[model samples]
Target chain A: MPVIKARVTVTLKNGVLDPQGKAIEHALDGLGFGGIGSVRQGKVFDVEIEGADKAKAEADLNAMCEKLLANTVIENYSVTLI
Target chain B: MKSAVVLLPGLNRDRDMIAALTKISGKAPVTVWQTDTEIPDVDLIAIPGGFSFGDYLRCGAIAARMPVMRAVAEKAAKGVQVVGVCNGFQILVEAGLLPGALMRNTSLKFVCREVKLEIANANTAFTRNYAAGQVIRCPVAHHDGNYFTDPETLARIEGEGQVVFRYAEGTNPNGSINDIAGIINEKGNVLGLMPHPENLIETAHGGNDGRALFESALGLPKAA
Candidate 1:
C-alpha cells in the first residue's frame, strides 16, 4: 500500500466579506509593502493516509472536506494529493 | 415544560440559561454534554451562547459536528421546541438545522450591548407572549451575528413569516441584513437568535422584557 498525503484548502466564498483578510491587506500597506491588491486568509489541512490508489484517496479527502473540514455555505475547499 | 440545555466545551452561557429556565419554567434544564448521543425526555432544548471549541474554524462549525448535534437535529425534526442563542445559533446554522450563515459583523467589530428588537412574528411558540410588532430589549454580544442568505431564500423566509425578531429601526447593532436578530424554522419549533434573552429574565438585570420569551415557549402565563 502506498501512503498518500493530502492537502485541503478552505477559503471564504468570493462574495462573502472577509474582514480579517481586508485588515491584513491594510496592515501590509502600512508596513510599506506595495502593489498587493488584496489578501484573503484561509485554512489549510494536511493529512497522511494509507491508500492503494490516487482515485480512492481523492474520494476520501473530498468526503472529509464536505463533512467536517469546510462549511459549504460560506466557503469553498480544494483538495490536493502529494 | 421540561427543558434541556446542551453543554459544549468552552460554552459559558449554560448557567445563565439554567437559571432563567428554572426561574421561568420552574425547573433547571438538564445539562446534556456534547458527547451524549441522546438527550433525556424534554419538551424544549436550548443551545446557549459561548465560544464553543473556542470558536475555532468558524463560530459554530466544530461544535455542530459533535455527536450531540446529530441528536439535536433528530429531536428538532420531531417538532421539539429548540432555541439557540448567540453561538448556539451559529451551531444550529452550521449543523444545517437552520437556514443561512452568520457572518462577521459589517462593522467588523464585536458588539456587546442592549439592542431593541421588534417581534417580527409573535405567533410562534417562542414569541407568542409578545404582541405582533412589539419592541423589546435584549443584550446582544457577538462578532459573527450578521446573517446572510441568498435573495430567494430571504424572500421565502420573509414571505413565510419565519423571521421572528428584527433589530428595531435605528438600533441595528450588527448591520444584519433587513435588521434580522432572530428567526424561526418553517415549522415554528426551532428558533435561532443573536441576542441573549437569558440575561434579561429579571428586573435587576435591567428589565424583564425577555421573560415573556421563556414564558411563551413554556406555555406559561405572562409574568406580572
Candidate 2:
C-alpha cells in the first residue's frame, strides 16, 4: 500500500462573524495596506493514510472532515488530494 | 436530589462545581472522569467550566468526543437534567447535545467579570426557583462565548421559551446574540450557559444569587 496525502481546509461559514480575522484586517490597514475589503481566517490540516485506492481515501477524508476537522454547524470544509 | 459532576482533563472548574453541589444538596456529587464509559444514577449532571483540552480545535471540540461525553449524552437522552457551564456549555454544543456555536468574543479578548443575568424563563427545572424577568448576578469568564445560530434556530428557541437566561441591562460581556447567557434544550432537560453560576452560589462568594439555580435543579425547597 502507498501513502495517500490530502489537505483539508476548514473555514467559518458565511454570515458567521470572525473576530480574529477582523482584528488582523484592521492591523493590516493600520500598517498602510490598502484595498482590503474583508478578511476571514481558517485552518488547514495535512493528513496521510496508508491506502492505494483514491476513492477510499477521498471517502475517508470526507468522513474526517464531517466528524472532526470541521464543525459543520459553523464552519465549511473542503478536501483535496495531493 | 443526587447529582454528578463530569470531569475532563484541563477542566479547572470541576472542583468548584462539586463544592457547590455538595454544599447545596448536602451530598457530594459522584465524579465521572473523561474516560468513564458509564455514569451512576443521578438526578442531575453538571459539567463545569475551564479550558477543556486547552480549548484546542475550538473550545470543547475535543472533550466532546471523549468517552465520558458519550455517557453524558446517553444520560441526557434519558431525560436526566444536564447543565454545562462555560467550557462545559461549549462541549455540549460541540457534542451536538445543544444547538448553535460559541464563537470568539467580538472584542477579540478574554472577558472575566460579573454580569447580570435575567431569568428569561423560570418554568424550566433549572430556573424554576426564580421568577421570570428576575435579574441575578453571576460571573462570566471566557473568550469564545459569543453565541451565534441560524435565524431559524434563534426564532424557534425564542418561541419555545428555550432561551432561559439573558444578559440583562448593559452588561452583555461577549456580544452573544439575543443577549443570550443561557439556553435549554427542546426537551427542557439539558441546559448550556456561559456564566459560572457555581462561583456565585454562596455568601463567601459575595452573594447567593446563583444558589437558586442549583436549588431548582435539585428539586430542593427554595431558600427563604
Candidate 3:
C-alpha cells in the first residue's frame, strides 16, 4: 500500500492586516529590491498519512486544518495532495 | 471567596495570581491542572497569564483544547464567574468561552508598560467596585494583544454593554478596535482582558486599582 501526503497552507484572510508581511516588504525595499510587491505571510504544513486512500486522507487533513492547523476567524486554509 | 487558578504547561503567572488571591482573600486558591476534566465548585475561576503551550499554533490555541477548558466552559455556561488576564484572555477566546480573537500587535512589537484603562461598564461581578467610566492604570505585556472581531459582533457587544474596559483617551497600546481593552460574555459572567490586573493589585506595584476586580468578584467591599 502506498502512503498519502497532504500539504496544508494557512494564510490570513484577505482583509486581515499582516504586520509581519508589511515589515518584510519594507525590509526588501530597503535592500534595493523595490520591485517586490505586497507580501502576505502564511504557514505550510506537510503531513503524511499511512494509507493509500486519498479520500480518507483528504477528510482527515481537512479536519486537522479546521480544528488546529488554522483559526478560521483570522485565517483561510487550502489542502493539497501530492 | 473560594477561587481556583487553572494551571497549564508553560504558564508563568499562576504564582502571581495565587499571591494576589491569597493577599485579597486571606487564603491560598486551589490549583487545578490543565489535564483535569472536572473542577470543584468555587465562587470564581481565574485563568492567569503566561505563554501556555509555548504560545504555539496561535497563542492559547493548544491550551484551549485541554481537558480542563471543557470544565471551565461548562462552568461559565452555568453562571460561574470566570476572569482571564493576558494569555488567559487568549485562551478564553480560543476556547470559544468569549468572542473575538487577539491578533499580532499592529506595530509588531511586544508592549510592556503601564497603560490607562477606562472602565466601560462597572455593573458586572468583575467590575462592580469600579465606578462607571473610571480610569485605572494597569500593566499590559504581550506581543499579540490586538483584539479583532467582525463589525456585526462589535455593534452587538457595544449595544449590549459587553465591553467592560477601553483604553483611556490616547492610551491605545495595541490598536484594538474602539480601543477596547476588555469585554464580558453575553451573560456577563465571564470577563477577559489583555491587561494584567494581577500585577496592579498592590501599592508597591504602583496602584491597587486592580484589587477591586478580584475583591468585587469575591463579594467584598472595595479596597480603601
Candidate 4:
C-alpha cells in the first residue's frame, strides 16, 4: 500500500449564520474598513493514510467522510487527495 | 474535592465524563441541568462533550446563554477550574472563557476519530502531568473546531504560552491554524478542547490517555 494523504476543507455555504465570520466583519467595519463585501469561516483537514489500491483508497476516503469527516447537515465537505 | 458536570439538554457525554472523572475524584461527579442557576460547590465544573441543545444557534452559542453557564462563568472569574470538551469547548469560546471561536471546518463537516495531539505547553494545571511536545491520542468529534482568532490575539496566546495542545506534525486536522487542539485561560486554570479525552478513559475503549486530565484535578477542588 502506498502512503496517501487527504486534504479536506469544510465550510458553511453562503448565507449561513457564521456568527464568528460575521463578528469579524462587524469588527472590521468598526475599524473603518470600507466596501468589505463579506466574511466566511471554514476549517481544513490534512489526513494521512496507507492503501494499496486507488479504488479501495477512494472507498475508504468516502467512508471516512460519510462516517466521520462530514456531518452532511448545515455544512459541506470537499476532498483533495495528494 | 467536589466536582460537578454541567448537563445541558443535548449533552450526550455527561455520564461518560463523570465515569472517567470518578477514577481520580474517588466519587462520581454531580450532574447539573442547564436550566439550573446554582452550581454545587465543587473544585471543577465540566462542560461535557455532546450536541448541546442539538447544536442549534451555533455549536456553543445557545449553551453559553444557559443559566447554568452564567453560574459557571461567575465561578470561572474567581479562578474555578472549568473544563469544556467538544460542545463544552464551543460553549466556552462562545461564552468568552477562552479566546477565539470554533468556526465550521473548511470542508463544512463533523469530524469524529482518534486524533494525535502534541502537548504544546504543559506547565498549566491541567497539563502539568504531560511533557511538553509529547504526543498523545484522543478522540475529536465536532463540526466547528476550526479555531479562529485575530492576528494580534493569536500572537498574545503564543507569547503567553496559553495553547495547551495542538495537532501533531502537519496533521492540521481541521484547518485550524497552528493545529490547535486545546487552550488554557490566562490563569492556566481553565481548559477547553475539541477532543473527547473522557471518551478514551479505559484501555478497552482504545486508551487511558484521558486519565491524566482528571489526575491533574486531584489536588484541586471545584471552587473556593
lDDT of 3 by residue, B32-103 (tens): 999999999999999999999999989999999999999999999999999999999999999988888899
**Residue-level lDDT for B111 in candidate 2:** 98
Candidates 1 and 3 compared: the better one by TM-score is: 3
**Model 4 segments more than 4 A misplaced:** A1-82, B220-224
Q: How many residue pairs clash in each candidate?
A: 0, 0, 0, 22
Interface RMSD for every prediction, one decimal? 1.5, 0.7, 0.9, 11.1
True contacts kept of each: 0.40, 0.67, 0.67, 0.00
Q: In model 3, which regions exceed 4 Å deviation?
A: none
lDDT of candidate 4 over A1-82, digit per residue (tens): 5787878777875534576677788889999999889887777878777865666766777776654455443457787777
How would the docking of model 2 be graded? high
What is the per-residue lDDT of model 1 for residues A1-82, given as tens digits with 9 covering 90 to 100?
6799989999998877787899999999999999999999999999899966889889999998898888887789999987
Chain B TM-score per candidate, please.
0.98, 0.99, 0.99, 0.94
lDDT of 3 by residue, A1-82 (tens): 6889889999999878888999989998999997887999999999989998899999999999888889888899999999
Docking class of 4: incorrect
The per-model lDDT (C-alpha) reads 0.91, 0.95, 0.93, 0.79
Identify the candidate with maximal TM-score.
2
DockQ of 2: 0.82
Candidate number achieving the greatest lDDT relative to the actual structure:
2
Task: State, as a TM-score between 0 and 1, how close model 1 is to the true structure.
Answer: 0.95
**Model 2 misplaced regions, further than 4 Å:** none
Candidates, DockQ: 0.57, 0.82, 0.77, 0.02
In model 2 chain A, which range of ten residues has the least summed lDDT? A64-73
